[model samples]
Target: MPSFHHGAVEIAYLDEGEGEPIILIHGFASSKNVNWVYPGWMAELTKNGRRAIALDLRGHGDSGKLYDPAEYGIGTMAGDITALMDHLNIRRADMMGYSLGARITGWLAYRQPERLRSAIFGGLGIGLIKGGGPGENVATALDAPSLDDVTDPVGRTFRAFADQTRSDRKPLAACLRGSRELMTEQQAAAIRVPALIAVGSKDEIAGSADQLGKVIPGSQVLHIPNRDHMRAVGDKVYKTGVLEFLLRRP
Candidate 1:
């Protein structure tokens, strides 16, 4: 793993394969390895002649961690991505993100369209505009002394995931607290780059993919059958649809 400084934060990342680049951003409580590499996404993209890049967002994985909620704003997190691109001398690249990563990608797609050849919002949909995903309860869960102390189902699930990942819960808690901002309908409509909205058909967390697709002009939607939020990440259907979208996008 190589790393570079983005302001005061050290962002750790993996760069693999060749050809045009596509950067992968993982969801909450997950790193590049757990979200992309262990799931074979890196192999799939690299084998298809694409440059696969994935980073550990600040406060997660091997990257620098911050306890201040103010430091983890969605826009600030998105800036980290842009800084990573600049460091690599990449002006633009295809971008894909899941869950929290999807929200960060949405922020970039809306505010920094010139830096993205295309955008993929995985595990996110109309919630991009509706403004609801993990909330304060999830943050509380991270703050809990143990998973047993987390009574909220969503919070408990995230706490268990954090435990499983061996993540430091304090920074994650601040991240959850600060990164919950949402894009408006106008912002979603303003995205002009090639875009794909991929969500699990059974994903309650992502809202409706079709609805989100309706908002983003010319965007394509792919629904992974019978998959929920977590299960959808590594689905073959998702990989196939994403590859097809990347192949055909302008």
Candidate 2:
């Protein structure tokens, strides 16, 4: 549970295993532990001889919290990832991210491709380019005083997740308000790193992984059957795809 500074924000992270580096970024309302460690990402990557480095994005986990809408976005969080890499003395490493993490990875792929060997995007799909980002629904849900007030299925789920994780509601609300930016089709096409788009076939939140892959050069899609957005995070198939992709690329 070590932490570092990215400007005024203190980003907490966990570094485990030993080998070539792989940086892991958690999704919205998730920390390194919930997103990667508790799900066994560290063990799998490390056992396969890769370093697993995970971070608590600024507004989540034990990292610094900011309620300002201006404080969070694609570039802001993506900058946090690279800053963490630089702090660890890692110029480049494989990058894996889920949900919002995947979006930040998208920005990384476009803004700092040299800082990544390959990018693994889980729980992201056709929505990566076409449309739909974290909109006001989820944000408003986080601010709702009680679950009884949230009616949208997706918003209710996110609010429940925030409650379950004991995440700060205010920061999360602000994060949702400010940080739903998605990469354009042209931006996705601009990624220079080898990429893998893995999505659950049943995921309502992310859409089609195969469709997203069609736009990114040298990208592949790994579809996990019967899993939805939350279920897909710790799926064995998703892990296997990531490990194999790393092996092939490494």
Candidate 3:
């Protein structure tokens, strides 16, 4: 339940164990507990003698929520994390993120590669392209009714997301609308640290395992069979794969 002020926002985080720190960044809409703790990742990391810290990103969980769309941009979000690290006096640490969190980690790696020991990205790929135009308003995108209005397969996925949003509407909607920008190839190639890219075998957004593996250089890709986006992180294969990758490094 401890919290830190990162500029105007308050980021809620959990710090456990007492060794080289590993920051776990949760996905859009989901809190730290849902992404890492509920999956037993914190216990697993602590049991292995590594310090694990999971943060509730701004506008999610116990963190402050800003209704302004500009406040939710990836750059702004990444800055929040760097500020959190500064507040803690941490020079560097291993970092892991999923979905929107993964995008933020990518921005951090690009901006301050020296501060990271290693990185793990889940449920993301190297398609760093801009979605909406620069002047387009994020609120407009979010205000549009559920994607069920469209006929494409991707639209169906968005509709499913919208269904999830109804249960916990604010945070997930903010995340979905906020993550309009994509990661550039230049940024992906710049990540020289030991990287791990993992995705569920059935993750529609990231595509097949081999396709994702080819984009990230020096990345070890693990496929969580019979699992899709929602179930991947909790799957035994995903957990074991991530731990093995993290422990393999110095």
Candidate 4:
């Protein structure tokens, strides 16, 4: 795991294989390994002759953590991705993000479209517009003394994940506090880059993939069969659909 400084913060990342580059951003409480590597995403992309780059978003995995909610703004997090790209001298690359990562990617697509060749929004959907996912309860849950103290169903799940990942919950709580900005319909409609919205069919967290698709002009949607938010990341249909979309994109 190599790392570089994006200002005061150290962003840790994995760069694997070679060809066109694709950056993978994990969901909240998930590291690059947990989100992409262990799920066989690295193998699928690398074997397909693509350079797979994954990063530990600040406050998660090996990346530097900051406790101030102000430091974890959605744009601030997105800037970390651009900084990483600049560090590698990548003019533009395909970008894939899940859940929170998807929100960050969507921000980039709207504000910095030149930096992305294409965008993949996974484990996210119309919630990008509707503006509701983990909220104060999740943040409060992260700060709870123990997982047993987290009573909200979603909060408990995320707290458990944080514990499993051995993550420091304080910074995560701040991150959840800061990175909650939602996209406007105008912003989504303005995205011109080739885009794919992939969501699990059973994902209640991601709103509606079709609705998001309708908002983003010319974007494609893929529904992973019979899976939920957690199980959809590594689904074969998702990998295949993304690969096919990549191949077909100009």
TM-score for each of the candidates: 0.99, 0.97, 0.84, 0.99
lDDT per residue for candidate 1 within 1-250, as digits (tens), equals 6999999999999999999999999999899999999999999999999999999999999999999999999999999999999999999999999999999998999999999999999999999999666889999999988888889998898899899989999999999888889899999999999999999999988999999999999999999999998889999999999999999998
RMSD of each: 0.7, 1.0, 3.8, 0.7
Instruction: Give the candidates in order of lDDT, highest first.
Output: 4, 1, 2, 3
Model 4: how far is 180 from its true place, Å?
0.5
Give one digit per residue, the lDDT tens place, for model 4 in 1-250. Answer: 7999999999999999999999999998899999999999999999999999999999999999999999999999999999999999999999999999999999999999999999999999999999777899889999999998888999998889899889999999999998988988999999999999999999989989999999999999999999988899999999999999999999
> Higher lDDT: candidate 1 or 3?
1
- lDDT per residue for candidate 3 within 26-66, as digits (tens), equals 87657888889989989988988889989988877778876
By lDDT, the better pick of 2 and 3 is: 2
Off by over 4 Å in 3: 127-168
TM-score of 1: 0.99
Residue 203, model 4: Cα distance from true site in angstroms = 0.5
lDDT of 2 by residue, 1-250 (tens): 6999999999999998989999998888988999898989899889999989999998899999999988997788888998899899999999998988998888888988888899988998988776564578889899899989999888899989999999999998888777878788888998979999999988988878888888898898999889988989899999998888888984
- Per-candidate Cα lDDT values, in order, are 0.94, 0.88, 0.72, 0.95
**Greater-lDDT candidate between 2 and 4:** 4
